[model samples]
Target: MVNGDPSRLAGQCAVVTGGSRGIGLAVARRLLADGAAVSLWARDQAVLEAASGQLAAGARVSCHCVDVSNPDEVSGAADQTRSRFGRVDILVNNAGILGPRAAVGDYPHEAFETVLAVNLTGTFNCCSAIVPEMVRNGYGRVVNVASVVGKDGNPFVSGYAASKAGQIALTKSLAKEVARSGVLVNAVTPSASETEIFGRLDDDRRQKLLANVPMGRFVEPGEIANLVAWLCSPECSFSTGAVFDISGGRASF
Candidate 1:
């Protein structure tokens, strides 16, 4: 009904972490529109409720208040989703943090740890919970929302960049592990996008990040969702452990 042609994800259940806002929210919306039952996972209960209310689907939506960095929390959330829908067919690891916009030498050590904890370890936790189920079912799609900085480091954001780079590596490693089990694991490395995450950046830092994109613009959340939706579909077969660069011409080599 949403797409009108065919629902590639009909009868599927997708779990999207950080689904309360930004790219995660957009991906949740698209997956719903494409007819997948969606379980939105976020750290904020109120915000997650508000996000779920934005979608008009009846009985096909759920939300989990969870911190992906916590293994127990991720496990409970994933179990709840499986309980709600019988199985989780997809996972979008979109939760992340934008660490302090300071040079590596000046970056706070605690901030660096938090960034990696959330961006990389959190992703691992989510995958740890959902991927085993996917492998059991012999079908799955995992999209790790990495960044262009992960591909090529950005000045003044070493923590953010390094964390995302770990996600890229994680994606590849997981893909190889589950390749023959009908599961596809891949990454979407996007450039600066118009999202609340950008608000975390100071103007000087934001401008420097944007200036590197040859397209002269920030990528839209919906645009990233579009690519993600397809990647989650059956048509996206034959590709795993690959980087889908949505960096607007910024990711060179």
Candidate 2:
């Protein structure tokens, strides 16, 4: 667990996409603990509502059901959030979909497209929707959730790696464009993390992947969330286009 002053984000309002589970859920919890009002967006209504209820008990929290891959839905959700919370001070683009694992030559075309649509395009959609409001306020924090595969190529997940690499590039370009606007943009790259997303992998494949992590274990979801919560805090100023790694011993750079 990471420790810091609990009131660092007082009076701030944050929106976390994919906040119903995994890293997104953890980030929401941390932000609330730090005194920020939070809104969680997810595609599943029941799950989103339940998570929102749990977080609301700790802090001011709201939930919006949105499929990041759909622009209309995301836009609508943003409108609802702004109406409910006044304005969003931090936006965490954490929603992503991982495709099936297979050699590049044998990977399914539909799976690759699905991954790109949800991972890369979804992030773009959220950024486009939120940046304008952030610019108007002259202060905002944006953290994109990327992956180590984006830095060092992973053999079987070409689509996921490519989408995340695109997100890194997006982080850099947006950072420069919005630096003067007071909107700091950065990306977090974590190695294989232990989350419900990993449940999709077969036991044999999961073990093989885990064997390569120098730390001898999958990264915890909360570990990644800690970095994201800090980056979203006001304390994280004068830093943009930065790539932070929370990959244990898996990342050397």
Candidate 3:
């Protein structure tokens, strides 16, 4: 749903991590339609290039292949983006990985570590890498993609919940630290969405997962993207450290 307003983000540049698919890709598309130059960052070179190519000619879009979990790679991607677009006005920390789910006592330590590394640490790494430039420019909008599980802890998905909870904390602290510097930091927590992340779950597990939602359905990626685009707009200046929810009717709070 591209807004009729085209100048909302005109001349701005945005970086969307994990933009190859799902919510990230939808966000990138929305931002581009709103007149922002967008760079899509992801781990797969083929997917990244293919997505970039799909954008219509003359669209302000580009692609970078990098692992958000690695600080050096995140920094490299930031460098490449700046090299191409000059400055990034917005950063969407959307790259994430959901590790294995199991009861606390049965869950492997490595699984927990991997989830934390990707979901929590990966968000931190990308933000850290890009904030310097954002600060120097005296303008920035950072949206960390968290989860509702981060707010109300979920069973079996303890590792993911914990990691996203950490992300919420990071978003709040970072927002406070940079509020005076013209950088607004916020987070979006989406409940179970209809995305490929559920591939890790068996049919029974997936069915059970959906039953817990009050809406009894998974959220659409585009719905999450619409919220994110607004948060990244100039109208979002006064807000910082806010955690916006897009969990359908399930997250009434």
- Note the Cα lDDT for every prediction shown: 0.91, 0.88, 0.87
Candidate 3 local lDDT, 131-233, one digit each (tens): 8788988999999999988987788888899999999999999999998999999999998986877775678877876776877888888788889998999
Q: Model 3 Cα displacement at 37 (Å)?
A: 1.0
RMSD after Cα superposition, model 3: 1.8
lDDT of 2 by residue, 28-54 (tens): 888888888888999999999888776
**Model 2 local distance difference test score:** 0.88
Deviation in angstroms for 107 in model 2?
Answer: 1.9
Q: Give the 10-residue window scoring lowest on summed lDDT in candidate 2.
A: 52-61
What's the CA error at residue 166 for candidate 1, in Å?
0.4
Candidate 2 runs further than 4 Å off: 1-6, 200-203
Can you give the TM-score per candidate against the true fold? 0.96, 0.94, 0.93
Question: How many angstroms is residue 72 displaced in model 1 relative to the true structure, after the best TM-score fit?
Answer: 0.1
- Candidate 3 TM-score to native: 0.93
lDDT of 2 at 155: 85
